[model samples]
Target: MANGRAGELVLRERRSLGGADWLYARLRQLFKNSIVILALAAVWEVAPRTGLVNVTFFPPLSEVAAAWWQLLLSGDLGDHAAASLSRSLGGFLLAIAVSIPLGLAIGWWKPVSEYLNPFLELMRNTAALAILPIFILLLGLGETSKVAIVFYACSFPLLLNTISGVKNVDPLLIKSARSMGLSSVGLFRKVILPASIPTIFVGIRQAGASSILVLVAAEMVGATSGLGYLIQYSQFSFLITEMYAGILTISVIGLIVNYVLVTLEQRLTAWKPSARE
Candidate 1:
């Protein structure tokens, strides 16, 4: 009984030590990852104050943070962020809904792909921004146009990646599943879909980034409320600090969205071996 109790104590101690080690390692990794961002921030803060850069044009990071805080307090940031996020999410979701199934169909059906290849090639080669005027003319300078442009910008990446994922699935896996007497639908559900998920997520991340970038540009045109509009208005009014604040907000939002998607991807692909491992 005494030996068992001693063993239990030892195990508990080891577990505590393991937990501590893991926490320390995580903190160290975080610091290493953050070093470059910290260095850039330090430079931004010091350059203007030390006259390494013109203070008028490039205000210190501290000033920008202050402006950002003021905007937050005034509720302007919330309102603009809401508008931008809504537009981005609307377009992004629409693209996902349309692209994924279509890509799967195109990849699976040779005839369908052959029929659409010419048109797909032509449209994919055309830049989203290059056709912005057409969207504006057709949809008008309203939320519809902005959302349409973002949707257009985000669609190609998602569609192409989905097609690639489906086409590139391992033939051996499909053969093995079929040999096991799996039906076509079962084979797709069990093997193809799982195998294609990582690639689909890659497209999702790209489309997410494109959605933000394109929406910001679209908002700059005729938007009365959005981060892009805020930046533009601030710049025109010579509110440089506020402009920087808006830009900073957009950057933060991008980082957050990317981090969220990465986390989701990691969770979904937990069975896959990571390079870090």
Candidate 2:
């Protein structure tokens, strides 16, 4: 009996070790994947120092980092970064608030959808940047104009995704819901909206990207502070290092935001992926 118990303990220890080994293996894969970026950075550092590339127009990454440091030390970085983030996220959320119910209503009511489709198609296709002048005229080029552009930029994706999700709900599910005597609202809440989450999130991601792009454009137009404004001012003053630094900030911000959204998506939709697996 002692020998059997020892054998069982050994097996349990081996299983625990195996699980840890699996986790370490996955971490190693992630590290290996990052090597490409390290190689690129090394090449970037070397190419400029060697004078193989024109460093004046295309500043080295180090200069950009130094410029960023300068900006941070000057205490202006926080305000600008905050402004950009506020505008981007603010628009994204506003878009979500307005679009979801409207999209659902349109999708649920065939006549409403038909009537609105033409206008939505036109509005979605319209250039968000082009409306800058109009917004300036109406909202006076302050925070409101910039935020409005962001809102407009983000709105289409949310609306489209919500509508598609509602419309594409399975007919079989609807039939079953009807047979079970579920009310219309119950069918929608239980069957359609839940099913649409994945597609809706795709639109949300796309709109997020669009929101950032429009924010940059709006900032370029007339903003005292923001990442886009930094880029514009740097370019105007021929401060290539500062310009690239601004671009770097934008890139890092986008990556971080996308990562957060992706993480949230994965967590919220955990059941879908888990079920599929």
Candidate 3:
């Protein structure tokens, strides 16, 4: 009985040590991955103080952190972030809803592709920012215009990628499914759609990035609320530190958005051999 208890204790100790070793390895990897960022931060904190850069325009990292904290305490950061997120997410969701279905149809149906290809080619070639004036004129310089511009910017990537995903599905997979006597709809649902998801998500990630970029530019052009507006207003008012703070906040938000999308992509594609590997 005593030997059984001793054996159990030994097993538990081994597990605890293994867990601790894993944690230490993870932390070490994190530090290694972050080394460049840490070095850059050190330079940013040092350069202005050492007069390598003008302190007036390029405040140290500490000053920016202080300004960011002040903005957070004053609730300005939250409000601006909320406005930006609402506009970007609204436009992103709208693009996803409209683009994916149309892309699938265009890719699957030769007639539909022929009918729309020319128009799509022309529109996609035109830059979204180049047509900002038209959107503002049609929708007015309100939330509608901002959302519309973001939608326009994000749509092409999603549309193009979805089309490519559908069209490029493996012929062998389709043949195999058909050999099993799968119907058109069943083949699409079981083989085509699943195969296409990774490609579709590539577009989704691109559009996600575009949504943020276009919205920031739009807000910088004209707006009363948003991180872009905050940065612009701070720059104009000569609140250099605050402007840097807003820029930093935007970077952080972009990183968070990208991380979330990547996690979602991993979850959805967990069955893929590459993902499992």
Candidate 4:
């Protein structure tokens, strides 16, 4: 009887576990992994307070927070944040506009793909910063130039991802849809677009990141009113605390952008399963 009861309990537990969906599973997985970050923060806070490490380069958490508070109250932080966001989003939006239709055409049409893919591969491989001088010469050291640099940096990933996503769309699915009276337009709209979304999103996420990186570099090179500028200014003045605060701002913005993109991807691609889940 004891052995039979144990088997019954195991079966019940498996069934219960199987009932949870991907969201619940992922939350559980992350819960198990977050201990390390909490421990690191503990160390950061503890070491400076205890004088185990020099506080000059690594300002105490309290000092950093104080600097951040002062910046926030003065509205300077908000202004810098807005400037960076404008540059990144403006460029990112332009990339999406240019890359999506071009990607579709290149992916679906063999002649176009063969003719254009080689050049695209070269551009994608080239470093964005390497051509900064050319951009500055063509557009000057103005907002237009900064935005253009970001667009150049971000467009490659979006184009490549769009092409891959469209090409890898299942022919069998398209055939079945056609058999069921889906016209070329209908089939593409319903099946192709939905099917390619997961892969296409990967490119979009990368493009978003590239936008941030390129914008920071642009600001570092010339701009005087962004988070990157704040860091540079603080460094020149030897205001180490303010410099660290600017760095923390950059980190926070990157984290927020990544989280938003991840959330959007999850919401849009409900049919897929994540590895973590």
Candidate 5:
């Protein structure tokens, strides 16, 4: 009788756990993640209609939505968005390709670090936008100039973060590895590189934002076919709704890019304990 009762209790406990798991899965599947976004959209939709702001300058959300749909349907938005994406990605990738290796070398070698530090500080201090005329003069009012602007804007963040991350790797960890007779290459590969991954990702995120910002400004100056150009043209033509739609598209693109980078970071760092826990 005792054994039979024990078996019955175990079965009941298992059933309870299974039910809880099922309920959690259902909740996750049914979650409405856009509630807050929808609420903000509602406010935007209502504000101009209520005369809280001038609809001419600050068009209502409904008009913006209509414009967005129209642009999407007409396919003009896609072409401009694609052009902007190409420039942004081209410059950003070039920065990453150059910055990471250079950063690693600087962080690892005292001579390189000392040699580059002053020049880096000087370059980083200068405003990237301030160099627009120089770039246009050198590279012409072409894709090269715009892309170079993005590269200049994005490189500093990643390069600085990489140096910081590598240099900040715990000294004790290096000592430990040295005591174990690890080679210089082995120490860097096994210890310093792993420790710096998170910080490097942080730099990547910052660079992505910078790339978009600089690209937009560069487009505003000379481009005839990017989202920035679209926004500028719409504003000049007094098509406030289209301008707002372009602005909204930029915001969404930024959010999506950041979201992707964040997701990638989370996956790569899953072994680390999250603050939420």
Candidate 6:
């Protein structure tokens, strides 16, 4: 009976040890995944305080966090954030609408591609910022101009990616669909689209990043309310902490937007192999 009791106790201890080991391994993986972010944050938190960087110009992370918290409480951040988001989403959605169909036509029709390629190349090469004055003159310093700028900035990547994706679709798949007596629209819908989705999402992700950048520039140049304007306002007033807070807010928003797009892409393309996996 004593021997049996000893065995039971040993088995319980082994189970407990196994649980602890599993938990430790999970924690280690989490740490490994987050190490770079943590390291950068630690440096940010320490550098200004240690005088390795000027504290006035570049406030410590803690001060920036405090400012962020204060802004959150004041409701200023939300208002500005919403305005910025509306502009970005408006322009991004518009770009998607314009690019997708046009890109498909360009990719599918030889005459369309021949007619549009030179114009696209010229517009794509022209810097959007360089034409800011022209946009201002044409559309004024209103929401229209900003949204147009964002649209122009985002459209090219998606258009180019979409064209490439459609063009590069496997001949075998196209021939198979044709063999099945599928209509042109049916072939495009069933085969070409599904194959091109992965590549199209790559452009979408790139456009997401570009939209944020263009929004910032637009807001900085001529806007009353936005995260970018907040940063500019804070900087001119010499509120370094608030400036950092605004910048951080933009970073967080951009990350969230990118994450959402990635999640959407993963869900939509579950059949495709994941680079992360």
Indicate which candidate wins on lDDT: 3
lDDT of each: 0.90, 0.85, 0.91, 0.86, 0.90, 0.89
Q: Could you report the Cα RMSD, in angstroms, for every candidate shown?
A: 5.7, 6.4, 6.3, 7.3, 7.3, 8.7
Candidate 4: clashing pairs of residues: none
Which runs of model 3 end up more than 4 angstroms from their true locations? 1-17
Quick one: RMSD of model 6?
8.7
What does candidate 2's lDDT look like per residue over 177-259, in tens digits? 99999998898888888888888888888888888888988999899999899899999999999888888888888888788
**What's the lDDT of the predicted structure labeled candidate 6?**
0.89
Tens-digit per-residue lDDT, 147-240, candidate 5: 9999999999999999999999999999999999999999999998888889999999999999998898889989899999999999999999
lDDT of 4: 0.86
- How far out, in Å, is residue 259 in model 3? 0.7
Mind giving the per-residue lDDT tens digits that candidate 4 earns over 154-257? 88898989989998999899889999998888988899888888888999999988899788877888888988899889888989889989988988888888
lDDT of 4 at 96: 90
Inter-residue clash pairs, candidate 6: none
Candidate 3, lDDT over the whole model: 0.91
- Model 3, position 188, has a per-residue lDDT of 84
Give a tens-digit lDDT track for model 6, residues 1-277. Answer: 4446446655775587697785786688899998999999999999998999998898889989999999999999898899899999999999999997888889988999999999999999988788877888999988999899999999999999999999999999999999999999999899989899888898999999889988988899999999889989999999889999988888888899899998788667766654633
TM-score of each: 0.92, 0.89, 0.92, 0.85, 0.88, 0.89
The residue-level lDDT of candidate 4 at 89 comes to 92
What tens digits encode model 3's per-residue C-alpha lDDT throughout 33-104?
999999999999999999999999999999999999999999999999999999999999999999999998
Ranking by TM-score: 1, 3, 6, 2, 5, 4
